[model samples]
Target: MLLDHGERILTASEAIFRGTGTKLSGKVAGIHWHYGTRSHAPELTAGYYNTRFRDGYLPIASMFARHGVIFNFTCIEMKDWEQPGDAQCSPEKLIKQVILATRKAGVPLAGENALPRFDQDAHNQIIRNANLRLPEDSGNTTVEPMCAFTYLRMSQHLFHPENWRLFVSFVRKLAQGQATSNSWEQEHRDTDKFVHAGGPMVQEAAALLH
Candidate 1:
């Protein structure tokens, strides 16, 4: 039923895009689907996950691909299960499965963080997922990097001195496509000039947080 509803929406969207004859026609990027591990029953096991993929997500991915749509997912920072008992229902496992499905379907895959986290560990996990560094993706030449990534939320907490510092480092590493050994002090120094020069823009961003 969910798949049918989604197909109907996509069909309508396709008609609007192809028939509009406007400059923005056919410019839709794709659709986003949020998959949460907690949404599954606790009793579900690894076999259930496999079946869900084979019967559920894989077909959905293929359908989206047929409509020339990208499949973007969330909670990418949940790299693995924290509890050994919950390993069977790990979000990372599902993420990897979806990645392979999108690849097979010939659709672009993108992701976003599930929660707001400014720590290095979370940043590293997101980077790894974005780059498809998992064992499943290893040695696969056809595996493509994520088309994009989005930070989950914006709040005053994100502008705190420490969080802002970490964010700057995170963005720098992502932009450069590699890690850096730069300390927080160094990042602060580098961003000082930009902050000073773009005071108005910075103020505007702060205003949005309020």
Candidate 2:
């Protein structure tokens, strides 16, 4: 969400293009921050993880937020940490980093997605700081089974637009009372079957949605 002087504002793709996490533009604010699930993922530079986060990532997030652009971030921890550097920071810490950076820039958190869920306190803090509501805990248990499969895809292939589309749609269905335990189980089995057979799992999932 975008805001001016604490009041809501409508921002379209054109205005949001600057915040889409690709490039930096003087005319736009906000930064797109993406991270892989593994520790020490090589998508960014090597051997300077802390520096990159503090000097590069946080600064960019801060700068964009100062100008009323929300710095969107996506981080997931789905597996064991592959490096000590990755283990040094908890998911909560990372979330705090982003929250702090954006707050410093005087804007609300643009958006954040953390797969497999974080600790309850982290969730609460996010909700509090971002002024967002959360799904009821009782409602969450029904969808817990799907978290692993979802985390698998997000960890391995979330950067792909098609995969993200399928994942988001499936999650939405779960949230909207359109999904059931049996259906999610079927979807998971179908995904596994298709992926194992080297088929396009996302497209297959889309067909399942219909």
Candidate 3:
């Protein structure tokens, strides 16, 4: 959810949790640089970080804790500062800013991916390790799996009625508790009654769109 210095966001989140009958698993709080771009001024960035933590983050965190919601806070680095109209700053500096603020606020840090070239396996490991140590060092560690997609593409064929039919049928079967097997092939058969490597998976995704 978007961070705001208002009570409405908290109340609305609670309402949604109750209404859906879905258990609240975890919360991912994201902090972004001002105006969607990195700030070059050190003092400005520091002030913004301190103010946001005190006014925006802390109270909401308290509310969630009162409601028994486990969460982790994260920051999004604007890696595209190399592009036009963006303020350029080092990824290391941006990361430091976030960690320091969350540390002071006594909130657990959430794992995040930013900075294009720094998303490699080694860098990811560093993030995971740091999060794991949070509980030991600060006694505040509630990290959740953060899924980052580097590649995703949508096929136009999914809009076709024929394609959507097969996809929907597969999902319907699953919703009816048909796919009990753990194996992919067996589950697909139980869900869709067919499995073809050429692209049954793609078709199944389209079918559910209807």
Candidate 4:
């Protein structure tokens, strides 16, 4: 846990991007930090194993939050991580919880993801069972999973034209030069993945963003 002014303001894994094991914004002002998720395919960088939305989505979002971008957001993690589910209903309960949490905090929130179920331990075993090639995204590209500091994604109850437009413009700026390769460089150097952003969620938000 991270503290500021003697107050517990940040959780460990959620502090950074969850799956990517990224660091977070160092703030404890009780302000709402924003984040995003479920936009692109996993990056298979050296040592960097990019898990799908559920595994590292929250951590990635936290990275965005720390950068003074978006603060309030959520992603759904389903019960079975192996079987891919619809991003919309993957983590139904988690979506609701994040919405409630953000509202109680009185902050703006965005939901960018699909709902999917997954079990970490079971999935790990399955990786070997299925003989799936493990892609690492930490040092030199592979960042291990950091479960403690993950941010969750939520669903949209209503659509706001103005907000969508603003978000679209924002993501377009971030996505300007981002791609799987750029993300690979950042991960390999142990730099910052949040700096390099863009995905389906950003694109969709842009289309809706006025």
Candidate 1 lDDT tens digits, 4-79? 7768977877778875553211112111122344434331331122343333466667777877777878777775
Q: C-alpha displacement of 53 in model 4, angstroms?
A: 26
Provide backbone clash counts, one per model. Answer: 0, 2, 4, 55
lDDT of all predictions: 0.64, 0.39, 0.41, 0.31
Off by over 4 Å in 2: 1-49, 52-55, 76-89, 114-210
Native-to-model Cα distance after best TM-score fit, residue 47 in candidate 4, in Å: 23
lDDT by residue for model 3 (1-210), tens: 233432466566677777666544234434343333333334244333334223344454455455545344333323435434543333443444444544444444444433332222333333333433333245545432222222112345543544534444433432343323357665445434433433566656666754
- Give TM per candidate: 0.73, 0.33, 0.36, 0.21
Ranking by TM-score: 1, 3, 2, 4
Top-down lDDT ranking? 1, 3, 2, 4
> How many pairs of residues in model 1 come into backbone collision?
0
- Give the alpha carbon lDDT tens digit for every residue of 1-210 in model 2: 122312222233336666576432222211222343343343234322433434334555555554555455544222224224533444444544555544445554443434444233333333333432223233343222111111322333442444554544444443443333457667667545545454476556545555
Report the C-alpha displacement of residue 29, candidate 2, in angstroms: 16
Candidate 2's error at 15, in angstroms? 8.1
Better of 3 and 4 by lDDT: 3
Which one is best on lDDT?
A: 1
C-alpha RMSD values across all candidates:
5.7, 12.3, 10.6, 21.2
